[model samples]
Target: MSHAFLKIYNNKRNKNFFYKKQIIYIKNIIQLLIIICIMHNFWMEWNNFKKNKNISISHIIINGKKHYSNDEYIKKTISKILTTNNFFKLNLTIIKQHIKLIPWIQKIKIHKYWPNILKIYLTEYEPYAKWNENSFINKNGDIFILPKIYLEKTVNLTFFGPLNSQLKILTMYHTMQNELKKYNFFIYSIRMSRRESWQLILTNTIELKIGTKDIKKRLNRFIKIYPILKKKNKKHIKYIDLRYTNGVAVG
Candidate 1:
């Protein structure tokens, strides 16, 4: 009888232990559910706050060299974008795309200040020379075009060359100009033919026919002979042919 009683006590003890373990697991699950509900409520409240806050952009500051009268247009564009978008969700890439539509602007930087301010920085292309007939070349050899009004006001040496030769022509022009400047000579225009032959018109209206090969050597030859030619009444000299190996032909 004692053994049977002990067996019943062991069964009760095992059942009590199993029940305690199940209770602990259920309590943990309940706590996890409560924490998850609290997180969900907090997220919803934060989103609601963002939606209801007044984060509209009220001030826009443009900072850069205003080389052209395009500030009004830029301000108009920014104002149009603000009409449909909130400051907190402004798409800077979109703004940049719109701003780049202006032809003269070379580089741009956009910034956003806290709550209600937007800032823009701009850099305009500095026109270095006239390219072909309708475009301008910057000091960096980049080609761009401006309106007729702006172009009329610009006075620069014109460069003519085959298509896609802006950088080559600009580089050669600078090299030749530096060499010529040592002798007080100034170039008014430069032209490169489709055959790659180069030529220049001096500011004094004299033309230089520089053939394709050995161009710099030929230029040096001309520089060597220029003093003697100037002594013989420079007004009578129309053109100088620098294509020969041992001598130059004057026209």
Candidate 2:
């Protein structure tokens, strides 16, 4: 009788343990379901907020303008549609793309001030170097092909290179400027070679051949020798080869 009673007691304990486990598992499942429902509700609310286009763009903000006349037309166009409400849809990539049509704008940030206002911030591109055949390049390497009228109004450095040659050309131009500061010689234009070497043309039409490596020492050598050579040679030399480890060879 004692052994049979003990067996029954052990079975009850085992069943209670399983019951407790099941209760805990159900509680966890309920918590997960509640969290999922809350997330779904939040997503739905966000969708409604995007669809609420009743509030139109009350104002347009512009920053970093070099010349006002060139960008006035762009601002006028934006102002026309600026009053239209409900443009910010859930997948409204079309409206976002239309903002880039502004000629002088380099980048834009779109946001909502809420209740009754929309805000747009635009950053205008400044010319870093002159592109080939009448264009301009920004500091970020973006090329802007505008009318010749814009070019005539401003002076920028001429930079020329093939598709893969931009990095090398930009580096060489900067290096030349740094070394030639003592001689007051700044590079007017940079032309790249097929072999990846750089040919720098200075203000006085002085041509310099800078190889792919050892730029500083080569330029320093030229700076030391250029004044002395210029005084001796009354005739304008064609080119100066600074690639040599010894003294520069002038022709």
Candidate 3:
């Protein structure tokens, strides 16, 4: 081969080798960066796992302890169905449902304090009056099963109505009760009939048949003339029928 041609060939071969080395170096650098990125992500995940591993339910506090519910029972129930034994991993929705099943529990709020504590705030139903033998009406007019211990005690303003009629009956009872209290008249049992008529019996066993129509008006009329009627014939009347428009029919 000629020296000039050989020299040119050698130079081209060296150039090709240099270009190959540069490509390999760049590939190695890219692989190292990828490895570093992978290691960084793995380390972050490992650190998170280590932190979560130590999280657990260390403390539980329940507020509003009265009447039917207490802390131990609530904690016991929450422990049973809690998705994770760890307080940090507990599902609030599931715990809320379990807690709300406690009788008379009206409203509840749950909060998770980080690192191992949980707080439960509970609000129970407010009992307005007694319904039937073993149930009570809340101030919101919702009926709840009364604890048996309360059934024996005399409940003020005894009420009876269709299950759906609780709100209506309760409202009517309150209105009449306040008005009647002025005349020293007290209701023994107020019942709403199937026909939607209302009749209330007094503590003295005298029934006031204030039918469906003009019920409030009839009650007011009875209250207005109660003193005169009681004086004239306290024991003479069997039942006072306020269904009459012109005058109260005495039965």
- Which candidate should be chosen as best, given lDDT against the real structure? 1
CA shift of 74, model 1, Å:
1.4
Where does candidate 1 clash, by residue pair? none
Q: List candidate 1 segments past 4 Å from native.
A: 1-55, 234-236, 246-251
Residue 232 local lDDT, model 3: 86
TM-scores for all candidates: the values are 0.72, 0.60, 0.68
For residues 1-251, write the lDDT of model 1, one tens digit per residue.
99999999999999999999999999999999999999999999889768756567778888898777477789897777876788778888888988888777888999987767889999888888888878888989888877678775785589999889988898899999999999889998999999889999999888999989887798899999988987986577899998888887888
Candidate 3: which pairs clash? none
| Colliding residue pairs in candidate 2 | 53-86
Report the number of the highest-TM-score candidate.
1
lDDT for 132 (candidate 2): 68
| Model 2 regions more than 4 Å off | 1-72, 75-93, 111-119, 243-251
Clashes of each: 0, 1, 0
Cα RMSD (angstroms) for every candidate in the order listed: 7.9, 11.2, 9.1
